[model samples]
Target: MIAPVVSAPTVSRGVRLGYGVGSFCTATVNAVPGLLLLYYMTNFLAVPAWLAGVVVTAPKAWDLIINPLVGRWSDRTRSRMGPRRPWLLAGACTLPIAFFLVFAGPPLTGVPAALYVGACFMATATAYALFEVPYKAMPGEMTHDYHERTSLLQWRMIFIGAATAISGVLAPAIVSSQGANGTVGSYRLMAATIAVILLVAMFGSFFGTARAPMTGAPEADRGGWREQFAAIKGNSAFIWITALACTQMLAVSMMLAAAPYFAAYTIGTPAATQTLFAALVGPMLLTMPLWVRLSKRFGKRGAMVLAALLFGGGTAAAVATPLFGPLYAHLTILVVGVGIAGVQLLLFSMLADVIAADAARTGKRRAGVLTGLWTAIESGVSSFGALIFGVILSLGGFIESEPSTPVQQPDSAVTAVLIGQTAVPAVIIFASVLMTLKYRLTPPVGPGPDESG
Candidate 1:
């Protein structure tokens, strides 16, 4: 049977723009540590590779338990400000503080450093969860109009692309300018800047969108924990989408984790590294409109398939860097970036679609639960990617000593880094592409209350 269509409140152009900005700031804060933390730990702070990986991965692991609980809480929260905004505001307030602390570089050695990093990371992760789960859940709550949803996502992608591109390019330059002693200082500055941006964006989003009129509590709302488990277990579409998201994140995280190493060792110049990042992210900003149009024309599934294929092909080409010169490597990486642009842009859009569909089918808006689960899964995959990359570097016999030249690293170590960047992610991304074939949910064509009954 066809589900009932829920009429979502009309979001103004200003509100949409505000949400887009908020998304961009959020992406910046999220991307920075993943992009630079490993390099900071191993090369700058003289931490061992394995230990660095542990620091990066372990704290985020907490999300596995916390995400669902947060989701359930948000789903049931009955507040004057609305269910999602409170958490968003709280996260915004605390996130930057935790972010600064993570990079503040306490003068500790050995186990002390590890413990400090882990605790700081855990705090950041928790704060991120508070913000991210609600923010992600917003799209599904914002409007049920299929075309409007697509438009909203289009705006989101535009800002997200811009933020990622700007931050990706500027971060290295900022770190370099702070002098040799400025790695920690640079990170602090970046965190502070990002925190401000995050705050402004989130505040805007919180005030911008009107809360959906929630009609009733979900079945899991009154049930015990077992009932919640049952609810999650029965939601096959959510399960598949979450799994796909996790795998895709694994691929992205692995590439992000290894990017600095590849730039330093493979391309041999910090300038080249910065340029490579620009080349990778720059096209995305320009192409978001095109991607949005494509998603509408081809439908989300077809668009994702095309995107995944492009990503996989481009990534595989990156693996061929050893066979070519630095120019070829840079070009290949840029190509991979183009593919990533489409994937990154569409994945969240598709998730929004899926969540809306699930609500329609279940007669309950569980955007929070779905987003929470997604956040948890993404955290695990991200952590696993970091851990695995570290293990690989450790196994490859990479040393933490500064190299006089980029090419000075052992051939095996360079190869390992390259493999981590390209070959490993390509495999996971390809699998995710195959899995997207099973995503059969479509945008409903009528207007009514969102129904899952």
Candidate 2:
């Protein structure tokens, strides 16, 4: 059954913060796996690049099926604690365990090791879908106000950036610090720590949003997955925005997979990988308000256009790569950082609106189902980031050596790293600008897009 939109009667700051902290879990799972899993498999475990990519991407095909099922289940659930939080709590408890095993591997080598990673990663991806699908659904149910939705997402993104820095950078640092990069012990220790953090943050969001309302009463009329899919198909804004988000995630994934390589070959400080990332993200943290203001003033699409321009410019600048040394390199990354901050900050808020609009248009409250697709696309694209990196490396003939030792890549591979980090993303992101230009979503409909064109 469709329900009338209901904005929050009162949304406490604590509730906002609690919800935001859940992103730490999201970022840890997303960033850590994206950043290091490829490195661990290819470089440390002696897995071939192409096969490693298959191990990474195949699980997400499973996620495409699992995400919608989980989403629909949450829609049908009738629980006092709310449909989303119970699942969030479940995911919080179990996700880290699978995450630990992804890195832990079995006590074997080669194909056996590949099987272990693929199996563990599938488990981890499922656990992520459990929390994230429902969690993504929450904002639509939690509030209907345009500005308020943006505020909630702002808090979430702050934690997301922090988690990216910690998970992406510090995890690699921990592995390298162990005297053997990506060593079994190093990954075990790192995974355990990340799992603990995921638990605290997920549980925090669960209890924090405990008092929030559901989207509607169990979606009685259009309760099936077929109905949910049809509802989403009606929303053009969601479609375009989803397209944009997928590409952005893919571009970001390529860079993340290439970060350590860029640092090693381009920046020439392999051990300072975390510091390099910090420079990119630190400005993102400090400059978020500017993006907030841009969205408020210029409209979200305009702001996204601005972000796309900055992203392109930064990627183009990356061609300079230490020619002007560390300062220039850092500044280029900083520009990219500011650009990404806008996308991350504005896009999720946009999705919440899309879900709301779909509910209103189709007269079926199916935020969970929509969000499941949203999260599924996100997780799937993220895994493909690794696949893309591995393909680029293989096509470029990248070398893998002992994690503790220096292995200089061939000039062709070095060029591939540069292309992955810069050119491919630049092209893909520029295309997003076209999609953003077509978006005209506003409060009357939602924040993502409303234009029939």
Best by TM-score: 2
Which consecutive 10 residues in model 1 have the weakest lDDT in total? 211-220
- In angstroms, give how far residue 223 of model 1 lies from its true place: 2.9
Q: Model 1 — TM-score against the truth? A: 0.91
Task: Locate the minimum summed-lDDT window of 10 residues in model 2.
Answer: 1-10
lDDT at 443, model 2:
52
**86-163, model 1: which lDDT tens digit per residue?**
887888788778877877777664567767878988998898888888788877767766666777777887787777
Q: How many clashes in each structure?
A: 7, 4
Q: In angstroms, give how far residue 51 of model 2 lies from its true place.
A: 1.4
Stretches off by above 4 angstroms in model 1 are: 1-3, 6-9, 179-182, 210-220, 402-408, 445-453
* lDDT leader: 2
Q: Provide the overall lDDT of each model, using Cα atoms, as 2-decimal numbers.
A: 0.74, 0.77
